[model samples]
Target: MLRNRLTRISAALCTLAACITFTACTATSEAQRQATASKPPATDCTAWVGADRNAMLPGYLLPRAQGTTGNAKGPTVCVPLLLTANQPPESYAGGDYHISEFTADKLKARWRDCKAEAACFQRVNAQIQRWLPPNKARATRSTGTVDPSGRIDPEGQVDLRKIRRPAFFAKAPYREGIAEAEGRTYTVEFTVPPDAFERIDLKKTAPIKLRGWYLEGTGVDDGKGGKVRALALMAPGGGGQLTAIQHPDEVTLRTDAKTGKTESLKFPNATTETMGQRWWRENLHALNQAGFDVLAYDRRGEGLSGGFSDTNTLEQGEDVFRVLGQLENGRGLRMLTPSGDVLEGNAAAGRLLAGMKANEIPLVLGGYSRGSMSTAWAMTSNYVASCTFDLPEVTCAAPRGLRNIRGAILLSSFASGAGYVGDAPDLADRNLFLGGMAADHHILFYPTSETLAGMHRWPAAFFGKGLWDRAESLEGTVAAYNRIRGVKEIVLARGPHSIETWPESDRRYLRERMVAYAKTVVVGGRTVPGLPRERMWKDFKGLVATTPDSWEPSSRPRTMEKATEQ
Candidate 1:
């Protein structure tokens, strides 16, 4: 019966497509068909388990061979979690895959039916949340002011003119990694110091630190017709320390130039931690080594900073803008027009730096992936010098309001598959298994040099070499920059996706070009230059190992040479 239902859905779609050529209709029909076929038939309860049902089970991974020689295998059974029925409807809408609750009897039933231990275990894997069914309710970026209790308060004023107070400004630390998908949650506990307390009642305070997923719902409507929502933090319930998972330093560097002042915001990847924060830590080093004095912080939900109910790309960009305004050098720069209205700023950093000691400084903004999007959006401010890095995959206002950027240093990055190309030849074959090599820190491709010499500070082991293929192309991102006339250069590098792992030579070359360009155009009153066409490509070729004499290949796991005697 289940199969019949799916077949009927597919047939209906085909018939609908034949009748209407309208894009939306055709698309919707096809989507419906795909959804039905892709999902396990709801009628097949014999092979199905829901999220709540699986949670009662005893494991997280599918059964596998165990012991030194290997306990070879077990029964092979298929247990599919009917996400639509098993998981909560709200969870599906909120981008959460956790089964909200489970009962002990359900676990026993699931286990008894498993053909193999692996099948039972696989049913409960929390990681499956990352692979949610398509067309399901998706989470998008949204923002509202957080209240005195660390709860989201949309009615609060965000006027820059007023000395605003941040609610729940305190520290909460906890164990790094603990697995409890169903009810796992962290409560942020902190206080709003009286001195910093301007608008809110001083006596009120609440939790700030947390990890896991949250949902948004309208409770209090901010007067402007915008409804308020809370980030549904999934916590089993308790008091725990919210340890800083990643602390990103947001540095805005400015150089006095003959023409005026130039400023650059660099977001260095985090370099402090080992296993847990590898992606973030490496990003800090990559941006730092690349010459960006990045403006970054522990994202609201991650580091030691305040907790947020919900955050999206646009919100993050707004936060970046807010930080730039708060800088010492950013005062009185004029964020809006004389007309008193504008999302884009004429001298966003300058206005933020107003009344400060530093004056006439030009600013450059850059970020990695999400951070890069923040940088791109900053270009809309007239005070900034340049905007560069991976193109943000999210929506952002154009760079139209800012001064003509002197240059852009984009890394292995992209926002879509349409324009992206596969890996360059040299980068495609480089060995990624170098034992504890610093190459991991670089995240970008290795230099074409004979050895992995200066690349040691990077952590290359965390990713596979296949990822290099995608990093080589920016998926035709240059077209986006071309829209901003007078933009100096767009330098694309080879290697892994992140720029930090690029060869030192590549790093230095790009930085030299950016600084020189900044000095001439924004400072020296000279024409900004573009990267000489072949510079980026030539560097990519150098990473390839053509002969045995080439740099020693990165190390990898070796198979046992001979069978051990049992």
Candidate 2:
């Protein structure tokens, strides 16, 4: 039965895939030439220490960003709530905040008198909450000091010993589950930076500390063909051990073939292809604080990954695929499913093909702006399950793959046209589009950006050849989305093009829908949690009325929504 269902899903998805001619969708003839061109080997072994002795800084967390749990118990470890550093002002819940490093000694000594885990930590958690903005921007930083050798100075390590009992839960399921693979009872590794860790000084009140670090083992699969994982130690500052942090997330170093120079790639950083990678790296320290095993790299033509020639979405996909291939190459951080479960990349692919796949943990494909659309296109294969598309679909066919996709988290999906009759007749049926004359349906419209310089328009650098750069009828896409048989284009509240533009409630709501639906469709069939129907009317009005000037619709509408419904 499961196999049958998956087969059906694949068939439906393939229907979209098949619409394209072999020549149209086929990879560039340069695949062989590019394949032979040995990418500069990735650099290895550049380590960094978080302000907190034992923890690793600059790591990202999994499970989309969530807000703090007020009235909570235990130490409040400040984890990054957002993914990118250039997040919109609205991404934060709304509060005055600043960055500072806290030592383990401070945390341990603060809550020295608390006996019960709950009471002791609750006081401190509240204090930390006060420090953050209501809808806080997820803190990511690339501004830390670099050593003379150009490697990240691994000095700011989070100490674990002083971590008091009862760690606070920022997001749901805060308690670390039993280490499925293997490890100790008190798995204390990968804590946040001291600056990120804060405790409220409540006199005569028991203080709070993080609930020790969890051991995220090594050699996990990267969802393609290899394994990637990290092991590190984090602790509180105390006992003359100011610099006693050991083993941070593995810093990979490979010599550039062309440059013939060694480069260091942090496992917990985002793949630097464009400015987005820079934003991701800046937050690794913040993400590490939040208990995420972020594995980032430099894709082709960007950062350490070489062989980039005027990069496009397809080339970017191959670059990302290589990272997975690297992880599966038996080297780095592995990809997990929506449920926090790990899988061998090869096995995962095989299972996907066999239709015996399960979503134990979230294997998130996070793309910022342009990358988001690329991620969506990449998932048309068996590689990824959940993707976060940040910009509007530049091309029409990109959105067609949504039907069989396990999760589609569109930060800003593009579909601003009169209707679905522009270019690319092939995409007409794939996108869940509505007719030009249809009544106002609950369409998934992306909001225009109020921040970022080029936030409103598609970047010209991305036009390689395919539909991405080509003009397609948004009308067709809108029609496809409306009629497509899958999750609706669930719109979050008015977040600008960046997910950061929307309020945390709005972003959280969207994430909840994505995660929940991911769990059901990808993991096991189950209902996802949050969907704000009440806000639909307001959201709808806001969407249709606000036409983003950034999106230059195809000239001479083959199809467009009628200005006046009549």
Candidate 3:
């Protein structure tokens, strides 16, 4: 039924203006089909990917995430939850499978048995909603006050004249991977005075200490625990539960960059016990159980750290750099004990970061949504990340190094360009995703490098996103996949904007794929069953109209020109 509604991406790409109203991968025009050919389905991209009900993960993964809800449960646990340098929708919608396809025998039958097209659509939609946990509705990004395109004014602001933005950089992925390595880290460095409530600035290059929880697992308890640790965070949860907790050195004071006024904003700071969101808590535990010590924290400005939040990828990448520096610098991080009544001053240094350099542990640079943008930023580059928003043209070339970063995991990546708006955007149900679609962040591929060394970071990667992700378009993610030139695997499933929002089945699947990936590239010396080993992805074009992602680009087109035509 969906196949009839879907058209090839080749035609969709040719029709630029209409593509915005819907997703790019699933066009609906019969005439457009004749214009061009769609890229190969995802099945052709790699051999490991099977139906949505199948697993592309290691069999040995059995984690016990102590405190989580939904699919993130148990020791044999169900499941849960990418890469960088940069960062999709559907021309190829309509996956034949569902996360619950095989599990719910009756529900699957009901969906499959109904012969009436319209009646079945209604029946399946209603039943699907009833079977899953209710989705928790979160507030969307404010369309007012701040326009990503920077087009309209706040409409209510008192003055726009006096305010200034000394620090700003073009969204990095748009440039593909040019001088992104050298651009401003887009992060601010400062110190919190125990007495004074305000923060003091040093420079951008200096490392900013971030507050997070670290658990050792790669080795036999090192008298304390293990040395080899891994890092994996949540989808773009803006701040931690301690969102109300302000950074001790918050110089920005949560002010609006445009009007120079205070805004009621908070960071995902740390508490004595909890280091991340529910999803974070679960994934952290999973990695620890998987034999890789896990280190996660409140990102700068988002939690109990200094500076402000820009939600930029390079900035987040720099944040990763700073935290890694603190871990390896021998300064010894202040750790809170498992008991709320804690201890401090590297008491677990032997277990966490004792006599060894932190870089020795191959870590995966990652994030979701805006977080994925930081993937490329974590790579080897001549340019140290610097953001001149506050102080114009300030260089932050501090001694930042994490040479052993083996891979990246980008979840629901950024669209390299402003993709399709809507087939009929004026309608209420029309998808109006912004952010990744922000014209300023509308990056495209122009980089000429096709070698692993030329990439900003190492090339081993696992890129995954949702077919239902409204924040990013399918075309945009392909652009991101195209930017990276190395061994990479791309996975598309039907879920929510963030992994936390996904159901247990989908979430469990994500965990399996993630653990498989972490074990292989981040920890090294292991190849799990069903692990993806594709070299690169081919470009795809289409106007998506809502369907599960079931296809992938072929490894190569028939000819060289066919590969580059789109």
Candidate 4:
């Protein structure tokens, strides 16, 4: 009705204004407006274009400016949410709100105290209202440290140890039937299950190895042919000590729908773990099953791997360079557990190499959380500092760029912004989104800025995150997905920040999807189902409202509902 009324109004205005003019007015106006959205006053549409390109600071969770019609100083032009995502915001119920009145040091100490035994820790979390925190932005945090418990004191403090004992029903699950994968997202890795992957196929051989300081997973069909197809190396989450992918058979128990009790029901396989073992067993299996020989290594100083290391950004990236280079050369990360108690897993599989040269193989690399950051930066800092690095999609992932790389898989990826897209104080007047929950989603351990600028350097990429993830922001991941200039796939499924927290079915599908994405781009050299790809972001001074033929649509501003937590 509004569009029809506008059409009639435009016709009336054209007719009324035609009496005083000699040429077609509305036609000229229509021609001047390049965007499909409502027309703005400027014939050039400069305000709309400018706002669209730079003003949508979604990282801050503030609303785009919606212009008013009668302002004497000209309209405060708006920019619609431009990036598209795989799912809508409603896929997740508003996450649970749990308060942590202490610091991470204090909280992690509690997990360590509990031995990570489900029953023991269940005792510790009695007073906590839920399994996860909303990660909302703080109005007045003394420090910027974001925990899963965004419910913080002024000093950026959260103490889970303080809330111990008593009632069984005080706390609710993030969702019944769904269990957290990494447990608290913020929970310390007090326990890690090694030998995490079980052999899914015996016909084609892949091996698990215990080299000196490295734990490795690698293999291909023995002498079966064609360059082992591809090799994908995945790293674990930075915070957890999880060494490898979880096996598919392992289960996570879910609470009964009627009651929020953990042990209420009789179903044994209540839920299959999404992430952090079979270390993400299914993802590892999917890639391997798709003919991509797989490798997963523990970062030095953490997991079972030896050697002292810090959480420095480039250090992890350097690890990739070492691991990938080693695999390419068919070298192991030192091999074996002192010759006796077992020549197990990959080592047990015997002579793991496929007898193919490095050039014959295509390389794909990735990881869970901070691990993904390592891969992204490694690709960035390797070379081509001044060039666009926009290789064609065919040669993009493989047969091109640094190290004949095929692609990257960034699960729980970094989307956009530096600090937080969560709520801020005194800024309620601005359109705030998701109540700033998950503001601490994948909170930064270091101070580097957003990595979106360098993501174009990546080849065929697959980005996945949960709908109600407390680990990373959904909007930011979508931003990363939309911004990548090459073949990319975004899988936003129903779950929390922890993939392991997702239902078993969703986990299985995602694992399969990862490999399928890899196979499509890695071997066949094609893009998968995805949103429109974009190249230029920061400095497009050209007529953005008119660039119609490219992957990016014309930037047109549109009105937005008042974004508030009603």
Candidate 5:
């Protein structure tokens, strides 16, 4: 009956397709006939298990020879779970082999019958026991935190006070054999599991420190002797302390740029912890090695930085300006701690910034995700203030607005008014910001695949009021900024929404391009070998041409008009 029902369904489908074209009709009809005829008729006691049923069973439940030697064997009896009922017969069984053909309902009935058979049930249950552990014996209790340091006692106990935050490490897999000699490292703090916090007797302590190392030849060996070497080594504290800037609202953790070991000071609030430290270190290390100063601080209401929580605001831009000013000239800089102690500015930062200014070193501003948005706004605010009230001539509005900025690097960032209408002011600010940028100023865009995917949906749901095409949206954005001067836009083939998720190749590509662009455009240094063309607009155009499906048609010009009107 089941087979007959399937046959009827197949016939109806073939007949419907037959109306579309004679050739498809004949071919489909013949294929359906062949499939139906080949299927054995269902038996009275058993039903047919089709391809769909076979796929439903978990793969690990399939019966197989026991032991790694493959010498062990099992009973020759065919278990219904392991049988491929839809396929051609591999062996002959009692009476008619057609009895194995069972539909879902019939299969369940047969399983009940098998369960009733004492001998068969015992055999099957025994086999099942080997594959699955008994429920009562399964592990369920939490074991607390497992120390990655391997310093715990034999019984899995440890001195919690000695625990420290872990260090992170990362290496470029794309440069596995070539650049495996070196690796990057950074400090890391781990979140404690909720269950661990529930332990009554366990005392909660400050984050412990662990040192991480990324050594060559540490990754999985690929039989070919070339390993994707990447290792993270974290050890307990060695008495090192981070400098803190105490403000009325918050205390900002500061790492001196003059240390030379410091890369970029990441704003903690801008991105989530999902952007792993290893990835952050890799990119920052590359820039640091190229003789660039990197500084990171927790923005207001994030990490150690104190203040109200807000994102991409003019106030945040002001905070950036203040930080830069502090770095440039530490004179009159002071931070008041909760204990009423006044902290003076670091002379090292003042000297570093002064030297750069004296030498006429151009600054490169870079940021990821919301940080990029913040950076863009900051630059815009500075540029807008510098221009004369009604003219293009420069006039100082603030003491530090990143004068002599050579380039901007934006990664995984969207336009100001990306998802909401409230961002219109910011969007307008960006338009003016782009107009203020010099024609020779370089801007590098590193949008991930995830970013493109998100932008593809922007016009339909969020930006419906405007005319937008995926390609046109991106290209027009750069063109709006007159990026024709010097622009490099590299779309990473694979990565999560965060630029920190970029693979080794993408990271290397970005580092090389950034260094090369800075060398040629900023510092007037020698051009690095193997760098892509100075401008990526042409390559981007080629990508759009070859992958037309990736881009959507632009909406009407009314969209832009609507945006401007807002």
Candidate 6:
């Protein structure tokens, strides 16, 4: 009987051991399941097949100035690709191609005639090589010097390290090659299915549904013989409302002033061609290549976006708030129209938002001319500060004050409305109020000295010379913002009222300043190099006192009434 009791006790112990093992395994599996559920889904790119050229690739056509003409060219096709961890692909030269007229048509015909996937890929690659060859001259080598103590020397004349063979150059033997195939234009090719090529119609009017992973290289140094890498998935571009969760819900309808009929507003979407052109014009893509996820879009009624182009500050603030909310929550934004139309949100956009949030990317809001006002209003408006958007089963809160914004770039800003928009309030007081509210964020202002000249030549009807002269002087504006800890103003020696029309040197300077400021304030959390900080206000005041009497408004009293009427 004792032997029987021992056997029963041993069996009970074995049973308990098995139960504990099973429980542990079950818990681990459940944890993994939860993690997988929270992760964003992979993007889908099958809808691009048989889509219109514009719908498939928005912003392909260049925006021509009035009365200006160019050689007739065929439709440009831009294929977005996915990038690898390796350096840029062998086919890419970090430049754009303005192919001769009809070159695009021949390329299109070749793409249509190709039967096999490999053949099609080869054809496209060949055309790209023929028309847009890699620019070897533009390729730059990483050059820097190091001291004996292993610290980087900013003033060193010679590079201590002999690795001048391009930092991205792979050393043979240990070098890991780029995976899969390389796109003819960029580093990595989008893993698009072969069959999708046959389905692309190019002539269809419907928008293409394409999504893929894209790696944008930002040539920022890691302070230790390495470069910083940042990636952003490409969003669909064109003249329509954004369906992606990464984008804000766009206002679509507005009453036409002439007919009083509610009509769709058009928004400009950045396409590959236009993106390249913009890179050439504004160096915007260079900013992306420099490590920032640049999201260039037209405000509600501007560009190709469908909506009443209204400049109501409150509505603009609301729109910016929704975008901020989407970025924070990784969710789609719900936009209710004045017509009571509830436009549904997109899941893909939410996934993109989730990815950005997961990466902990910061935002830098920037604008030029009227856009400056929009950005400023967005920062200070009550609507944006307190607004929230309803996601599908979740509530996404808007940014509190300027909490999410790390910096603001106001180029040729009319925030003060001092001399241009009519008998407006003192711009100096308005700037002080807004600047105080965003004390923690960095603000960079680029005011022009040749605004009077620009107004007399091109925009004279809208902007009076007196108004332009006063606003562009930036004396009061600088003094008002000088008290803010992060505020800094740069007076361009001679630049047009329109930032877009500024010379290449001026534009380059602005880009460098912007990048440097972003690096100092956001990445390094330090003071900007070469900036006069508190001393600029006093120095500028002295300069104003010594300036010619002609620059003063009192010297030209006759124009004051005319300026006020505007």
Give all candidates' CA lDDT scores: 0.26, 0.25, 0.35, 0.36, 0.29, 0.29
- Candidate 1 ranges beyond 4 A from true positions: 1-128, 131-294, 308-311, 328-361, 380-409, 415-472, 481-484, 524-566
Q: Estimate the Cα RMSD of every predicted model relative to the unseen true structure.
A: 23.1, 25.7, 21.1, 21.7, 27.8, 28.4
Please report, as a residue range, the 10-residue window in candidate 6 with the lowest summed lDDT: 456-465
Best TM-score among the predictions, by candidate number:
3
How good is model 6 by TM-score? 0.37
Best by lDDT: 4
* Tens digits of lDDT, candidate 5, 1-566: 98875564454333322311223343334333333333322211211112112111111111122111112354211111111112325573321121113211223334356567887556544433332211111111111122233122211223332222212111222221212223321111111111111111134243221111212122223235542221111110001111111111221223233531212223223222212333444444455444444444333323222222222123333445554454355543433222223344553234333244422435555555444444544444443221111112223242133445544555543332221111112122222122211111111111111121112111110100011111113222332122112433333312223333233444555556654544343433333235333222233222222111110111111121121210
Residue 419 CA error for candidate 4 (Å)? 4.8
Q: Name the runs in model 4 displaced over 4 angstroms.
A: 1-228, 239-275, 308-310, 327-333, 337-360, 383-403, 415-447, 529-566
Q: Which ten residues in a row are the worst by lDDT in model 5?
A: 458-467
Q: Assess candidate 1 and give its TM-score to the true structure.
A: 0.32
**lDDT (0-100) at residue 338 of candidate 3?**
34
Q: List, in order, the clash count of every candidate structure.
A: 70, 113, 66, 35, 28, 18
lDDT of 3: 0.35
Q: Tens digits of per-residue lDDT for model 6 on 96-200?
A: 111111111222333344423665545444433321111111111001211112122222221222111111212332121221111211211011111111122
By TM-score, how accurate is candidate 4? 0.44
Name the 10 consecutive residues with the lowest summed lDDT in model 1: 232-241
Please give, for residues 1-566, the per-residue lDDT of candidate 3 as tens digits. 45532333223222321222223323323213311232222221111111121222111111222222224344322111111111122344322111111111222233344424666555444533332111111111121212232211211221212111111112321221211211211111122211100112222343344444455554412223334445443323444421121222222124334543333223222321122243544554565667655555444444334333233334455456545555554243444333322333344333344245566665666556555555544442212222211122222332233556666776766423222211112211111112111111221111101111113234566667754344444544544454454445566643434554344555566677776776667544443347433212233311121112222211111222221111
Model 5, position 221: C-alpha lDDT score: 32
